[model samples]
Target: MNAPITIDTPRTRISALATDHTALLLDYRLRNRDHLAPSEPARGAEYYTEQAVASRIAQVEAEAEAGSALHLAALDRASGQLVALCSFTNIVRGPFQACHLGFSVDHAHEGSGLMAEVAGAGINYVFDQLRLHRIMAAHMPRNERSAGLLARLGFEREGYARSYLRINGQWEDMVLLSLVDDRPGA
Candidate 1:
């Protein structure tokens, strides 16, 4: 409920998306659609349409406004351009103060450790500032890079979900990874 977490990097920062950032958001989403497609099979060229993107943006903002979840936009600190996105979604408050974490980086920025850096910052905010106990990441088994990043970030492989979600048009399995706040008695 505190201000949404802002992640700062040497060259960029990740902050909540403002409605006025439509242009940047659309560009980021469209530009990264290819890089993100493999991981997010549900996305397609049609999915990147402005109407669809705007609807999703509205949904995210509504969720944030309702105290349900937070969506942070990764911006190049120098140019002030959106390059990526990371979000905590489907948040449940109360005893289950937890949510699903998901992200995508512009292909131009991949292999630069930017995703991991952003994730570390976002996870810290969820655990420390938001006081959440757990953040879950689900990825397809074929996404070796994503799995590796989760492991490197200290998230444990929790389990596997069969047909966890629909990717593109087919049901796919997901490897569930979790990061827990193990701070003494936390």
Candidate 2:
């Protein structure tokens, strides 16, 4: 299995979390609870606890060891505060060679192109490091920000799904998009 990766962008340092960063995960979750509550499922207050975040960190790290998934966090280069997160989950190798992408940005960094900067790096890592042939992402129909970002990233519109996911206790329609890596030997 490959080790967790770290990349330095112009304004942020992006890397996967380790088991020791439980407090950092807790703080990031608590700070973004309100900002992320809409699209994510409710995990109650317990989910924001340090123990829970530690367990989750362990879980994702194990998945990384298994080559099944990864979660990359981007920290501000100056302050070291987490500014964004990108997850590439459900990695299927064999003949599929694909995975699902999810992301969120700090509300303070919204509209500042931070997500694009971080997510672009994540996508490149997925393709180059993971050697995945394709990456899939979906966003709610009302989320024009996500739609525009995916478009700018060159993800093609795959198809619209009706009630594709149960988000925030409600079934929501999703606009699915995908990007394929067509480089030599991909």
User: Which candidate's lDDT is highest?
Assistant: 2
TM-score of each: 0.91, 0.96
Quantify all predictions' global Cα lDDT against the true fold: 0.82, 0.89
Model 1 misplacement above 4 A: 2-5, 44-46
lDDT of residue 101 for candidate 2: 95
- The stretch of ten residues in a row with the least summed lDDT in candidate 2 is 17-26
What C-alpha lDDT does candidate 2 achieve relative to the native structure?
0.89
| Best by the TM-score measure | 2
Q: List model 2 lDDT by residue over 75-130, tens digit each.
A: 89999888888999999999999999999999889889899999999999889888
Poorest lDDT segment (10 consecutive residues) of candidate 1: 1-10
